[model samples]
Target: MTTTTYPVRVDGALDDRLNRWLWLVKWVLVIPHLVVLAFLWIAFAVLSFAAFFAILFTGRYPRSIFDFNVGVLRWTWRVQFYAYGALGTDRYPPFTLYDVPSYPAHLEVEYPRHLSRGLVLVKSWLLAIPHYIVLAFFLGGGTWFATQNWEWSVGLVGLLVLIAAVVLLFTGRYPQPVFDLVLGMDRWALRVAAYAGLMVDQYPPFRLDLGGDDPATTRLERRTPQSLPSASPREPTPRMSAGRIVTLLLGITASLASIVGLAVGGGLAWLDLGMRDSAGYVTTDKVTLRTSGYALASEEVTIHDDGATLLRRLFGDARVRVLADDGLPVFVGIANGADVRAYLAGVAYSTVTSPGPYSTTYDDHAGGAPSTPPTELAIWRTQAVGPGEQTITWPIESGDWTLVVMAPDATAQVAVQADFGATAAALTGVWIAVLAGSGGFLLIGMLAVVLAVVRRPEPGPSTLEPASAGRSNESEDIH
Candidate 1:
């Protein structure tokens, strides 16, 4: 728990060969791949839309929305594998057809690369940040916000991918090139699992008879089992250390708990920024007097409400706003709308006021909770002014405005909004590029998933035992 972290300087973060190939791989190869992802997602939307059409026109599902989503996820893993070099061709595990499965294989997978498992995992997850951006904008932007079904479908796919990557890390299949406390614990867990699974008849590699007419199996003259030389002293197999296993389990728990804490804290921060009050009209004192601190909110609050009563006593234009100063929260508004009920999303949303004009600003995540971590996220200025005056004013000159999203105060809002818009637009654009580039490589990836699902090789008959035999084993074990 020391704040200091040891740093190891190396010639390169990856193999020299990979570094040399980075140009070819990233631009030429990766670009086409991401372009493919972009188009593919576009295609997915098209196919889904067509599915709806087919349901109407032919009374059949052209494509199962569920199956299509599953396929998309499988394809994602395949591409990750290609990036990982875990398997030949793609990440889709080799398929086997069976009435009942015999051996276990991962339905979800992550690539195992030497000690660089954490980095590998980072690459896998980070690659899709771009795709998520595209999906967010394409799905959520435009005239209408994305439907809940659409949100759930994409969200579930993302969740599955995350779970798969986490399992891969905890299995110790992905090595930690850097000394990862997280992975070190996982190594101990894997060792313990290996021992426990082998405690009984876990991995019974059957001895096979040396076949006739095989040179590799040159047969010695037959001898009785007792004729062999006195057995050399065999090394005793080591049992899993109970102390180490306990320590590892605790480590895993701690790691998970930390992640959950960060997520909750970060989510709350995002909510607060999104629900701030800017319009400065609605007075809690006034509303409290009218309905004893309560009034029924309408489904929609427009410029004018029904009848003669104004929603809030405001002199100028009605506005509601929330802003974040470093890690803290503040709310301001004129006529607080009925939608306040709906604004109780995550913590970040709680801080949001009305949408501002000009460009996108990443909601400032002012790091952790009260008296917490140093801020990694930058801060933005928050202010309000009278009508026809600038909410934000640029320092370059008195009359200057940056870019216009919108603001009651024009001059100051311009400079700040422009800066935010530039940063946000760049971030969004990068994410889109990543999606498009990754998609290109993922055409090969999609093929892998489809083959695994649809073209799996049938297992030989002996590979499976009949249900009666399985039942008999259960009975004997019970007895």
Candidate 2:
């Protein structure tokens, strides 16, 4: 009996001995391969796009383009196998696009002389959707249209390779079973890739053919349907161990926690930016005070609302300073619009001075005495004696305010200096904390998820009925 062959074939052999620490550095070693592959893939995409139009028109894939694209895939596979892709080989991948027979990793695709003009338009995209969905879980999910900015998960195959690398690191032996499963996945992915690349017409099978060799090629000699050589009939599907399940669950939880932490940290950062002060102010406004008995001078200054949210207003701060030249004592107080008006209304004799639209000055004969005591909204107050200065700083809220300067026993000339500013360093600290915490959590979660997926259990062994029984029944019927 003649056997049929699959057009796409991918195979690899695990190195007998692997350097325990080499896997860690393979990422660095593959930089040259990566740089070259980057350009090759770009060409591969352009050529593939061109091939699509060619197939659409002529019902034939150009042989030269097909070979070159296949070579790109082949080169990529070898680098992946040697490094994070499979960790099945320790041999450094060569830089060439052509096949190296001595290299443990190999890939090939048979070119078709003719293709269906109708299928060419849809097969690579529409008809291949099912296979694409399956491959997403194995090779990492990404969008077809926005491939340049593709976001992919750490897929099952990558996770499995990572597990193999770690095992090799500790025990110095690549686990055969793990390698077999990883190879099977790689084969499946490549076959799909070939089909989508327009190299073959046959659809990729959903079956998991675990081993270094292609299962389809090996099954050709047998007349009966091929079954898994080691799977048991009772439990055909693979079962993950308890430890692996626990690990996956932990990974999932950690990922969720990390995502939540990122949100909270971002919110904190926004709040800090909105509330914290980024600039400082030093205002030196001149005011004259009468040295005669019971004299007071006041200046009304507008504190414009900066449109900050109520929470930010509640948390902000402003510092005020009052200085006098007469070397006597001065009493300074800040009162709101209503309090300033009522204080001036009750004064027996007073002079009013208007500096700006938002401010008004008042001279009082009662030494700044008010008909009623100051309101609680009076935000700040201080006393300056002699050449000494008075300073008061407090959390600021938004409103129109008045600066009241009064003579304490004697009159004087005063220079009122007030400073207001924000704590920007606090905002920066919050932002850094958010970024570092979220980034760290995300990194750890991704690693854990990959490891958990890789360590999942393999499917049970399959049982096959004897092929001779059908032959014997036919012989009995003939007799």
Candidate 3:
């Protein structure tokens, strides 16, 4: 057994002449790649977690899983190289996970045969914390945390690359110094990723091996022969069958759908609670009313039309309750300004008065007709017999209206209360049903995905491949 430097290697050659405008559109051009990578990363996360437990017990990273994960990293590096990582390549990245010899950006990791079971538990998360902290400043941290707020300055590598891109756009050359720095940062990040993924036991170095080639290879003198630890029978690489692919796809789809459902359901539930519990009706501070032979006391009430949905409008209503302490009969009626004015004008001896449109109080109650006639609409009145307490409710509509309270024969003090109901009980049932149904589909999708990832595929003769055959040779060349 021998010791060497880090096993992960990342390399990229800066293209001589980059297109001035291409960098601007590179993000758009790579949308398809980003979409595919999104799903691939999800699979990668699941596989990495699975590999964690496997290594914990068996002391080996599954060779097939290793290759697939490496491919994902490789593919991601190429896209980043072309777009924001290094701006090192103009050639479009290939969609396949297998290496493309012609592609400018490359990444490869030497597979570790026997992993320390004890280290596997902490290295990916705990041991990698320092590297993660450094990479956070370099790469701007993981987008998952960055997305929680508006702070966009997370990725230092991306910012520098953009500067390099601008320099390239104007000067037609990617600065050598900038490119080297970007690569160093990228290399550092990838090294941390590999370590955290359980691909290597050698903790990543704090040093930045800048430029297209790794500098450590020249410094490290001896290389140990890589060997698998004695363990359970090695299984052949599993070929992903069409059925397995479908199952994984179903799982991914369901997981994504469940996220959407949860978000929507949670939002709807919040809205429903707000509507049902909101203060629906507005009440005025008690105003003194003189109850005497048809002496009308008019209090102006204005209702603002909330442009709510038709369903809410259909289920919503407004009610006015008249309360009096004198126990004398009180006549209460609600009408748009015009009808009340007409009715009062016809009464030979009655005094009709109201407050200004914006005024909530009726203090300036002057004699004669109101300066402004209330907008006329339908009118509702309680029986003139004056039941001390009466309530009238009507479908809610927006407008400025007046509440006319009259004492038929006696003088008594009184006040009116308005209550608004904005939601129906039935809607709560509907929302619950929607949440339950969406949640059910989401659970099914998640189950499908977990099963697909946890269950090992069947082995076949065609699935056998020498895992060592594709190990990166760049390290040897660089050394």
Better of 2 and 3 by TM-score: 3
Tens digits of per-residue lDDT for model 1, 162-198: 3433544455232233212222222222222222211
RMSD (CA, angstroms), candidate 1 = 24.7
* Number of the top-ranking candidate, with TM-score as the measure: 3
Q: Which candidate tops lDDT?
A: 3
Model 3, TM vs. native: 0.55
Clashing pairs in 3: 139-155, 140-154, 140-155, 291-411
Q: State residue 154's C-alpha deviation in candidate 1, in Å.
A: 16
The digit string of per-residue lDDT tens for model 3 on 1-479 reads 12445677677888877788888888899999998889778767767877898998999887667767877788898998888877788898887665554677777676565899999989977999999889889988434363465445558898898898888878888889999999999999888888888888999989888898765531211122222122125643234556766886777776677767778877666656654444443333333434333335454545665643453444565555565556666556676756665555533223335432232343333233332222222355323235567656656465556566655442323333323244454556656876897789767865675555443443222122223432333133211
In order, what lDDT does every prediction score? 0.26, 0.62, 0.64
* Candidate 3 deviation (Cα RMSD): 11.4
Candidate 1: residue 177 lDDT (0-100): 32
- The runs of at least 3 residues in candidate 2 whose Cα sits more than 4 Å from the true structure, single-residue gaps closed, are 1-4, 142-152, 218-479
lDDT of 1: 0.26
Question: lDDT tens digits, residues 213-257, model 2?
Answer: 776632211111123333344532333456754664565566666
Residue 352 lDDT (model 1): 22
